[model samples]
Target chain A: MRDEAVLRHSNIWRPETIEDIQTKAELGRYRIRGFSALRSRVLPSFDDLTFIPCTLTRVPLEGYREKCSTKTVLGTRFAKKPLELDIPIMVTGMSYGALSYNAKVALARAATQAGTSTTTGDGGMLMAERENSRVLIYEVLPSRYGMNVHHLRMANAIELTVGQGAKPGTGGLLLESKVSDEIAAMRDLPAGVDQRSPCRHPDWLGPDDMILKIEELREATDWQVPIFVKMGASRVYDDVTLAAKAGADVVVVDGMEGGTGASPDLLMDHTGIPTLAAVCEARAALEDMGLYGEVQLIIAGGIRSGPDAAKALALGADAVYVGTAALIALNCNKPIYVEDYHKLGTEPYACHHCHTGRCPVGITTQDPELVKRLDIDEGAERVVNFFHAMTLEIQMLARACGKADVHDLEPEDLRALTLEASMITGLPLVGTNVVFAGGPGWKKSTHR
Target chain B: MVRQVECTGKTTREINQEIRRLIGDGEQEIVVLRPQARHNLGVAVLQPVKLVFEGSVGYYCAGMADGPSVEIRGSAGWGVAEGMMSGTVIIEQNAGNSAAASIRGGTVVVRGSASARAGIAMKGGTLIIQGNCGYMTGFMMQKGTIIVCGDAGEALGDSMYEGRIFVGGSIAEFGNDAVIQELTPEDREFLTSTLTQYGITSARPFQKVVAGRRLWRFDKKEFATWREAL
Candidate 1:
């Protein structure tokens, strides 16, 4: 018998998995990329739980005619004029430097048409965006790039961004190629310069220092607009509690799956928690502090469909923010221009080269030619359509669950599909009363 | 007639509220008395009124002035005349840190000394400091002209983009990404006119500090040279 030796493929620490080692060897610097977190870790998510519709005990509402309100009131805890949105979904912050001017205008117009709000991201407020948007939330980022008192007053609300879902502890990285003359003018940076926004605000030190800044903002705006504290999902319970104590009317928690203009892949995929776990922890923290209803919670990161929105609502989110999904809705990776994608060294959906300033979809690039490809009117229409579809889906789900209002969704309407989800959400598994962690039969003595 | 008001027993909020009400009533000339070094005096003044403060004021005095012309008769604390949009703010005495920070299309004149980071991040405005300026003056400044008639401290114009800083006296040191450029004929003429307008006629040979432009674009080889400057 001839003995044949077989060489098995190694899965543990695979050396030839895409040959990232070769790329690192060829280039001294690690590859910088963009887009959402692409890690394959199986974490607890909204998909882990399924909603239970109306049956014998519960009564179902009419889907076709009956009115199910999706109205959302935010920043009611402190601000004199809290925001009233016709829909619960709002556009997440995407800076002008990271996106084209036309993209920003499109988002503003679409949000206005959808009867929701849009956010002014890292850079200062663009004139077109401010004029088009009915309710604009101006972001006061750590960089303070375009912070002006007049612009601050122009906003309906102000968001103090400490971190993002993609890179929590790191600052933003804008490549020199993207920092055009126009963008540099807006950001107050040298044209064609690589910019690294500071990770922390230059004026504030810690939570204690945050109190004074919040007061300063309140005084600056005459206590008219709501103060939102946005944090990337890390130490969710503690961060949410601290934000509440710091006098935040709204707290936005972004998970690891959040997208960015440019970031190190290590930071995006490895850091922060999942959106499902973050919302649960945030709600738990608010509930524990007895300020759940007072301070609204908004969740983001990987929110795609209406089912995802409904599940997030049931898990304790007051509203939802869409960034990557919104971009996709605007034809970010629609495979329309194959030649342009080829020139970018990428394809439609697989493109993550936003930092290169060569986006084929015209959503993220600052190049005038590329920007012109995305028509403002068409983009706005797409956004309005996407928002309407999402709203309809959410309303449909709510009516099915016999909920008259979208805010009426609670965890009781949901059941965990897997034991891991049950443990994470503290919900009963399907067709079982036992949670195994802290359910009806949980006992310390028995577990010990 | 000057519409005079007293802030002796009122808080900053009340004083500002009264100011707002007076401005809303179309009062062009207003006088505020007994300021007593209080913070946020004349903040967010949007009207084209003339506001005169009688006594010393605290931090952020005359903040975010749009069309108002404010004259502070006494000294000010930190962040004086910050973010003034379209007005003239005259500080009679010394000002603290971040004086005239991020001013956009306005004029701020400080008669006395200014602390660190004066005119920091100023976009479009003219800041004239008659007295000496502290370290990091005009740090990361974008588009503005800052004239220091007296001596300047360390790191002047550090990481500045396009703004120009004219120092009439000796500079203690230069900041990163900053270089002493030759005083041009246009710069000298602009400086002379700006100073003459501000009633400063001293013939101190001025040195202009502008961006080196080395840090504008990132090159791996050039980062080593400009890293210390930033």
Candidate 2:
């Protein structure tokens, strides 16, 4: 009704922290809070969702029902072995403090079943996660919650979490409700109280200190793990470049639509660049520095489907990290638990408290009874199936593009309609010079 | 042969190698004559053999112990027993910050009081202090037990959970979620048994404390704006 509302709606730059976003996402009326609408907005994840048919111009390979190579390598730039993940989909970090132990267990099992890596959240290494996951990446956050020096040594990979898309420069809080004996033990916090993780790491002050922290962990672990640094997608190019300079083996950038277990509503709806903008900036930065192939880019936030994975790969992400998607696989919004949603003070799928742990789906809760409702075996199977389907779909699209590998999916195949997107992503507008590769927007090399 | 291993001049790696050799050779106990400052950066990298050091050691003295009884005759340094896996570490003298912090299992006994921030961010296991402890003892500590024979300096057991803190002396303050509770007979029995397990012969009564049970989950209303690091 007002000019401000029109401008806000028309423009991508809301200047709002994610906290203010109200999805108006009705789970049959009890609107889900704390998340940006994944489906809204005019920007298409991709156009035509089309794949160029294999022809004389582009030769398609029949996906080996038997032998077409599908193995993906992660942390290749830093790790000696570089994980040979069976699929491209990754299970993102969901803390043991925020979600039930069984939920974490299911995620690990599911990822393992799908032959992909599962990341451990701030709650440290889960025994189930460690045993189930073939390749396990450990997350190191500001709070040092549940971070054990020994486990750090044992981690297959280590991710230094700088910020989340939903909540940036803010701490992680596991409310009093989720703290069970196990959760408390994992995070080393008392149950039924807010376990707030500091926003800044105690020992690491800035990017420079973060570099040394990387070396310290590498030395401590005898250089066994590939180190990954993740951040909310605010200053994408600068952050990605700095991360690469800081010796990150992989850079994980989570965009605005990224989901969180628990964050202020103001932060969830606002803050950070969109996923499309972020992936483009990070890719350009890496490619400009000749670190594109050398340093892997993993994108997160609001990735929910195979086509989304394809869009990310086309945008130059080596792999995709799925958070909300995996939760969905774990029956996050399954229609069956409409009743459970009400009991937890929200609607099924809309109840993201993953911070509350009272999830009736048995996904997020510390209550022994609620936790018991989740069967790791069953839940894990669902996750595995979801990954399998997404991979198949991605491969199908890749085959349509006449591409043999995921890396072949290029930005030339993509188109962006919004001026805000062009500015935010730092990407060359398709067939236009408003933006160019190694674009005019490329930040000056301050590090070199 | 006294088999007296003098660590006073040896590096951590060299001293630890000797400790491993003796323990691996079936020596139930071994004596470490002395140690230089900062003696054990990764002293017992993973060996759980019982050990005794005659003199003071420095930072991370007993860090990451898989299973071992590492005892120092003199005071110890910062981050003692950082994330120690199992077994026991004893300090006959005082200790610096973060004593027995983040231990997954086992026990750490300090005959004297611990310095400031003792057991900060501790995970599991038992910490026994024969004397008083410094400020913010057990800060952000979760799932374990801490016993103090003397008064807590300030803000004892800040942000503690699940585990119990039994202090014979007065506590200056308590952290969020941490509250003093009546020591039940079961608690007394457990404390007594736990003390016996560590051979802690103390006469004062122990007070039991615990973290209130609650959890924060992701949902619509609360923490809607609290940003999370992706």
Candidate 3:
């Protein structure tokens, strides 16, 4: 007790996390999303489910050596040069102030090793991460950080964010409880106070101005980078049509289940269209505009595995982006952090506290000490491993489908369960082509 | 990287001619806004350039630059780098609104504060504000990131689709289709790196602001969940 008496007098934890946090359902909180909702609510019923059972005419993709290749090209619609990757999985954009530098580094390094690309979120570009990742997708958002000419010149592609699926129209908040001294400095904001970011752009008032803006970027960067526009699924047809017309090389649509830095529980469970529905609308929009196949479509939000990806592709997505699943691969719920998760009033599986950078496991903090918990090399390797696993799974699915390449999995290969899906996606059902029209045995949604 | 340049000078025709010549001669990188840069009333346009402005710049400095990275040494007049796409523009000093109006891709960083409507209707790209900003920043932005280090005026990020707004200081107000949520692991991880990358190691504990999910429209069950909570 004599030796421990002195140590007991003071706590070593950062002072910011202990105090300064009041209420977080707050409209005045800092920017970003990814938090657990304090209050419980009636969860949305996504109970509509169906199964793709095996039959005499249907066979499953071989899992191991089916010669299934998972490879695809993106952004050739407008850019003279497009990006090529060795694997199917790519890192999605998360932000600075919402994540730690080490996290970014891991993503960059992981993407590099996996031979895929990593995206920069709303927060400015981090040099350490950039140097590691050979291909980087820079995000142009409503809230710009560390933005400049130098970085743009280095970018492979630029994604213009309109909304995300998690909490589509909602602006996110990062609480001061997670704010480390270092994070505060880069952002140039006061320490320990809730920050607010307006949800709108102040420059132009309409689509016409957007056209000019796109022109300016082309002029400035010599048109080296492909400019893709991203939007939350709202008026899917209208939004994608506008984006294509606005000169986007690619259109990314995030479904309702998309992750966030920290969104209201109410919003995440409530907002936006599902990935399947949105894909249909977006596909229709591009087809009508004669830009389909020419303009690539990337779907994100709740994609988990190779099968999910195949399903999305069958529904018409060129590629599917996975965020939460990637985090899981990065050790999001390793059970080792069970105690830490409890400290945040959540569980390991509920590790969505992006609002507060003060993740107990050291994945998202500016504090040098806390950040040390993250072994960058090990983390990067984990990400690479995850990518490899996913690629293998995609290959398995493709081979089972009797295809040599994952890209060969097209919409025509899918069989919808409900008539609504057949009508929306134009795919035939498992054993019958009469999904929406006529078939021997079929079921239609009563709502339709 | 392909580069382009446009000179904003009295002779609009001359500036255009020079830019075209530079491109023709295989000069992929160009800088139009140099320190102490001066120009007459002329409309200039550029494709892309790793351009720099060492000194103060004049009006319409980067009126229609596309896919070029332009840095301005001094403050700019009205409509500086208006309608830029796929390139980056950094201003050492304050800027007029519409600095990155309708920006499709790339980013714009202002070391000093920005006037009103800095990123109006920005479709893509990012706008960084090291200093304070006037009202109506990020108004109707279809997508992109806009970060203000200093205090922001009213109605920021109004009706934004995607992208995010991170600020260190107090926000005067929150805009339409926008609310505040908590930050997650990825967000904190990003903040640590973002601060270190740009010598912004000074500000700790930044807040992340994102667009409200309601804009994408809602389903009946989803709508009920949101309503019941409130």
* Best candidate (score: TM-score): 1
Over A303-404, each residue of candidate 3 has an lDDT whose tens digit, in order, gives: 777677776765567787777777666676567757766765566765665555546666766667767777888888987887787777667656666667
Worst 10 residues of 2 chain B by lDDT: B221-230
TM, chain A, every candidate: 0.95, 0.85, 0.82
Q: What are the per-model C-alpha RMSD values against the true structure? A: 5.1, 7.3, 13.9
**Best model per lDDT:** 1
| Candidate structures ordered by DockQ, highest first | 1, 2, 3
True contacts kept of 2: 0.19
Largest DockQ belongs to which candidate?
Answer: 1
True contacts kept of each: 0.23, 0.19, 0.12
Residue ranges of candidate 3 with Cα displaced over 4 Å: A1-63, A179-181, A418-433, A437-448, B1-79, B82-230
Candidates 2 and 3: which is better by TM-score?
A: 2
Q: Cα lDDT of all candidates, in order?
A: 0.84, 0.71, 0.65
In model 2 chain A, which range of ten residues has the least summed lDDT? A23-32
Q: Tens digits of per-residue lDDT for model 3 on B1-230?
A: 54434443334335545655776676766555333444311123345546665567654566545666676778875557655656667788888766666665666778888888777656566777888888767765556677778887898777665567777777788888767768888867776675455555536456777777555433445333322222
TM-score of each: 0.85, 0.71, 0.66
DockQ of each: 0.21, 0.16, 0.09
